[model samples]
Target: MDKAFLIQFTGSMAAVAVLVGLAAWARIGRPSPGLDEARARDLLAEDFPDRQIDQLWIAREGRGALARSGACALVLIQVGDGYAARRLSWCQASSAMFRNGQLDIRLGEVAAPRAVLAFDNWPPKDLAA
Candidate 1:
């Protein structure tokens, strides 16, 4: 490639990097909101209109939640700057472990295979719903 072309390309790349860095510093993307019961309910309502949440548990830091709807369980987890929700039977879980006040669950999902939820208590009363 020509020297002038290389110089221009390098300058353009540097400019893009600077913009990305600034965006990151400013937190341009929507970070996960602290999920309260109402917020979680709203999100669940929007996602699963047919089901009604009978019981709900939010992670200590609002990182995730576990909700019981009818006979199934719903999981809401933070992914990147957003959240992902999944409804499944607890029996479908590949594994579950309690570590340092957090419960790690493997849901066997390709997009969101695992969720780490923190609660004040370990060995949650209801691991299955």
Candidate 2:
């Protein structure tokens, strides 16, 4: 193979690798068995000790959860090997809706919101709804 061709092939391969990495990073863990409301509250309780959890719902697939604590809505996602959560409040430009058995809550700007909580077959009243 020509040296130039090898260089181009290597560059293309690198680009592909980077794209794959980004795609993987964009998604969290696969659905699991521990997304129930009790589990969600227990998880949040570690961080939000005094606040009351008004509501919570685990996605049908168990990949994500959403909850209302005090004045803010907490969104928890399975990230990496553990979990990650974000708080969205009415103070920000947050909006929520339940469509087709999925609850979608978006906070802040239209681009991506400070946090986006989308739960499949979510239960309870959504904070923004």
Candidate 3:
């Protein structure tokens, strides 16, 4: 290999590495901050302005939340750097299993399919309805 060619290739690789490091430091595409009940409600409000959440439960470590509005249920999940909301009836969920104070709900959708919410007690009664 020619010495000049090798030097140029090495320099290009270093430049790419530096750019990646700078992007990481800047938190480009970094995930959104953890959510509280109030923040989760705000996100739901944006996507579901007409609906009001009657009850809500925030997931462990702020991963997501479960909320009930009238007869419909809504889930707030983290997608990339933001949150996404899905409204569902109880029948829409493929499954919901509770174990160790967590309720795992499967919505059976292609985009936002599943959510695991944590509660201090067992799953809420209205969750199944």
Candidate 4:
């Protein structure tokens, strides 16, 4: 192989390796738990013991100029009522952003409305709310 060609190829490979390494490093400490509805429900249950959650919705913030959206999951829990409209806010520290973050649940034409619950850092004294 020509010396110049070999050097160019090696440099390109090194650049690619650096980009991959940077990406991996950046994502290492980040939370990528797939933030699905099931996980959100589990977090809600752990956070709120007495209160029962009937429905859950997860919404991700849009990005870039085009406003590309992220993943979202809808969870339906089997409670006395089918589902209800409720407002919930999850703690930032916890990964329960699905139900915790800024979002609203609508009952619409549903027969029952799901009770909205927010999961905070510390457990509340009374689980009534």
Candidate 5:
């Protein structure tokens, strides 16, 4: 093969490889357990039996340096019929586990709120609160 042609071919391959690597990295940087509204509601129902979930939101927060960052999906659970409100945070890893029916919520920091009676679902009962 001609030297110029070989160099050009190698350069093109390198560019394609870089592009593919970037795409994969971006995907891995995203948080897991990307649940839709219906699935989120079902998970909440199983965790918090009686309370009706009003809304659920998956919040992704990036941590660490930009090059090595990781994302976490925060499940915000909200509940209530009227003016009352409560909130709970089911961390990304925990939410994924629970969504899979593993039930591994660390109730210590992210549990039922005493003042507002929050439920354990995505967008916990009093999310707005």
Candidate 6:
């Protein structure tokens, strides 16, 4: 390509990188506001009555929750009403990423996508992968 074109493209890319860095820095200090265990337990209990919740992560503003039981993994995300639950039995997740302000976890697919959970990362954890 032309020298001038390459220079302009490099400058634009650098600007984009700087903006992304600033956004990430802003999210650094703000820790996730954890969820109430009692409420989370109650919600998890609704779907998984038999299986006990082993691990739980809730969004800051009570937007969503990621819960794990002995048998399966459950994700309760805010749609329109309250929180809708998505269950994963075999647990074949491919990738999980937290970006901008949302946490997106992708599961393995057969015909279409097996499962996908998109929630806000509260008590923001390091999602460097």
- Local distance difference test scores for all models: 0.81, 0.66, 0.78, 0.38, 0.39, 0.61
Best by lDDT: 1
| Model 4: worst 10 consecutive residues (lDDT sum) | 61-70
lDDT of 6 by residue, 1-129 (tens): 999999999999999999999999876654434446677778778877877777776665666677767656677665444555666752432235566666665544343343233455433364212
Instruction: Give TM per candidate.
Output: 0.71, 0.52, 0.71, 0.29, 0.27, 0.49
Off by over 4 Å in 6: 1-35, 89-94, 106-129
Native-referenced Cα lDDT, model 3: 0.78
Higher lDDT: candidate 3 or 6? Answer: 3
Q: Across residues 8-107, which tens digit of lDDT does each residue of candidate 2 receive?
A: 9999999999999999987855545657777788887876777787766666767677677767877777765566766678434234566776655664
lDDT of 1 at 25: 85
Model 3 agreement with the true structure over 40-123: per-residue lDDT tens digits: 989899999999888887777797887878877888877777778888884443247777877777877777567767766555
The window of 10 residues in a row where model 2 has the poorest summed lDDT is 114-123
Residue-by-residue lDDT tens digits, candidate 1, 1-129: 999999999999999999999988887675657999999898888889999887889999997788877667789998777778988875442246877888888778787878889988754677543
Off by over 4 Å in 3: 1-13, 23-32, 90-95, 125-129
Error of 1 at 45 (Å): 0.9
Is candidate 2 or 5 superior in lDDT?
A: 2
TM-score of 5: 0.27
Q: Number of clashing pairs, model 3?
A: 0
lDDT per residue for candidate 5 within 1-129, as digits (tens), equals 999999999999999999999999876643344445565555545544555544344322211000001232223333331111223342433343344312333333434422211224433454442
Q: Residue 81 lDDT in model 3?
A: 77
RMSD of 6: 14.3
**Candidate 1 to native Cα RMSD, angstroms:** 4.7
